[model samples]
Target chain A: MDKLPVNHMQLDRLVLDWMAEVRTYILKEIQRPIIVNTKSNMRDLVTNLDQNVEKIYIEKIKQYDPNAQILSEEGFGDEITDLTGPVWIIDPIDGTMNFIKQRDEYASMLAYFYDGQAQGAWIMDVVKNEIVHGGPFQKVWLNQNLMEPPVERSLEQSLLSFSGIHLLYDHFQYQTMARAALGYRVYGSAGISFIRLLKGQLGGFTSVLKPWDFAAGLILCQALGLQVKTLDGQTVNVLSSNVILAAQSLVATDIKMLTNTSSNL
Target chain B: MDKLPVNHMQLDRLVLDWMAEVRTYILKEIQRPIIVNTKSNMRDLVTNLDQNVEKIYIEKIKQYDPNAQILSEEGFGDEITDLTGPVWIIDPIDGTMNFIKQRDEYASMLAYFYDGQAQGAWIMDVVKNEIVHGGPFQKVWLNQNLMEPPVERSLEQSLLSFSGIHLLYDHFQYQTMARAALGYRVYGSAGISFIRLLKGQLGGFTSVLKPWDFAAGLILCQALGLQVKTLDGQTVNVLSSNVILAAQSLVATDIKMLTNTSSNL
Candidate 1:
């Protein structure tokens, strides 16, 4: 087994302090005017606040470790093509649409990678002022409290969360998956949806997610024993956009079976 | 205009106080073992806590008005076939499925009817300690603050909230309804979804709702000038289960046109 790094505790403390500052800025910025712009498509939204938040993370991370490599959503970090030593991944505002529309149900996510392996992760539930952060070396903490590992839930008994467009369009046979589960819901925010899974309140959450979208969630799921994979049952690659399914083991199996059956049909 | 009831303010005050008591009981009961059972189907759930909560409302309402009739999800309520004088409609736990499954998104709802008219309504977003309550003659208050009337939204710019099952099944042409809007969401709780509409956070909410599911929402929608009708655009009968579509006026018109166009094809 790999040992916890000698400086891991210190680094984690610094990240939490930086997050405190980032959160304070976000809480203030939300009250000000939000300037929204679309990327990729009209439905894919970004805001001045997203850029501003990312800048904070970049500045703070650089201040903490000048040699650390960073990857982020708003282009504030290194444009590295591969995960390397002492790498930081940040999604400064994971649910910009929710932030723009509801001013709630959004989060800030960060993850730490070393030598192509995840070492630490953080997801801040911005509205609720709760944080889920930990890594392979530490028990996950939801804010200051230690979070228990999620209990396994079967597909038949648990609610699944998926994007509305994906299920509506029957992407990956999600419509049939919804019917097989207890039910399905979509909050339109990946970070909020992931919180439901971390809390064991959801069976699964499937989405086409970018690196930052799935980075922190992947790390947390690893520590919690939840399954994380591409919808086709391949392991998720942290450096690329993939169709991700995060779920308890049994639910993942059921989803795979449903997908296989649909494909055969 | 119907004159504001001579004792409407006083009655509203009484109901709010009753809600506070009910909220306290719920906050405590959530920590206890929730005794759950299914109704109608496995997906349709009811809990012992739901029954216990309804009994409190029954006892309190009967104590306050001996002649007042009630229709509720639990059998604790009166079995009146018609909307009569001094009738109370209650769904002690509006999102019983969510409550039993997720625990945070559920609410307790109460509505008042007199002489076949929706007179007053209250929906307690239990976990948030927020109450959305009002009637034909009074302004709706979210928590202690008065809520402004919802702004009208066009179909092209607004997010609609509909049940996932309905949209997946092509019920009422919901698939086309989703495609026309900016997007759609399903929180799986009618009262919570209605709260989103009341706040102008969502353009509409559609579902096949029971009388208890929609009675309070109907009263609030009337007060706020939002449209509430069946999918075929008929007025909702408070005494009967119906397929309801509640939305801003212009959005409703857009949906009607879309539904009309799809049927034509």
Candidate 2:
């Protein structure tokens, strides 16, 4: 060890430990009765719990690394209009509606960007306490253990999850896409829904999602060595919302089938 | 008492006990490692688990209620060429791909229809073991307890789930509907995915699902006081695929958004 500068192993441990703290806080918050409040409709929701959880994370980050810049959903952190230096991109609670109602299909997403590129991303399944996480050069982990490769599900054998609108509107010819694939589903929660893509359950799905909605998952997919791209197969811009996003390689093969089917509709 | 009807209290208990047994058998199958086989494109999938689970339920139903007919996905049961009598519509695994791949979003669904009208429905979250079920009456249950009334999760405030293809292709104008809802989620499992709708966690949803797919959920939603209809807000054909399905009083509100926001394409 003559040329060792800093211990990379220790840094990894610290990140894992920090993630544990985040998980605990989230679980505690969930255990408490959710105080749901609607934003625009009974469906557009923002619970006090969502705000509280973000506040807790902000406080924790300040103590652990005051120098780290933050971008949060609830506007509880510093203005991070730019992704520079060691920036923490946090969603605090990804599926607010699920958090308020069903208590499942919710996630806590966090991503780190260093020098404007993703360094690591973690998406915690709050109900299960398992994390779909990725770092540079690593297979995704469900909870510290490497997950098995996504099941080799085929389009006819595959099951997909995406917005109901995507299919009903055939905005990207998804209805035709459905005919080529095995099956389809719609959940209202985006952050928590795409686990199938990362795990290789869904062939592919399309969504009009914002940066906060896609950021952590996008990074996690990249880390897992899966293709994460716009529906047109272009790179995702963290600053701009993609018209569509999908799981890579296998799912993409069905695009022709999708387009062919939807055009007639 | 002047007259007595064969102790309904006892009959209810007997039915509950029978359901409990079915639930246990279902759980055993769900827990077992699935046997995934491929077809179509890389996105399609099928599993030995789906066939096995369906077989177990059909056998049990025969042993318990031998004369009842069944409409099932797997060929283990008789072909449901028509819906003329008391038929048990069963989807052994609603989210087969999820079962084979994600192991999370799949569900075991059962519905009984008498003369093309629902008598009872059961939608069980196999992964979580929570069954949100009931029928005929305007009430639903999870396990032993009566479920709380559905919160007013409106389309704008609600999280809606649908097949992503529908929206992408503008099939029945799903994209506009989604823009009106709180958000969207696409899961691979239909029987399992619709649990929220019955429980009142979701405002509503729609998909091109077969009778077995919507049978149980339709009954359960009716009991929960929701409006279930085709995508065009028409009373759906119970024996065929329904283009849309969702809550009752909210139907007009939901459909208006879809039709208004929809483009001719």
For residues B59-92, could you state the per-residue lDDT of candidate 1 as single tens digits?
A: 9999988899989998888889887678999899
Residue B66 displacement (Å), model 2? 3.5
lDDT of 2 by residue, B149-216 (tens): 57664566666766655655657766667777766666655675578776666677778888878888
Model 2: native contacts recovered, as a fraction: 0.58
Candidate 1 lDDT for residue A211: 90
In angstroms, how far off is B111's CA in candidate 1? Answer: 0.4
Which lDDT value does model 1 have at B265? 98
**For model 2, what is the C-alpha lDDT against the true structure?**
0.68
What is the per-residue lDDT of model 1 for residues A101-217, given as tens digits with 9 covering 90 to 100? 678788999999888887899999888888888887876888888888777778999999998889889888889899999998988888888888998889899999999999999
Best by DockQ: 1
Runs in model 1 deviating more than 4 A are A1-6, B1-6
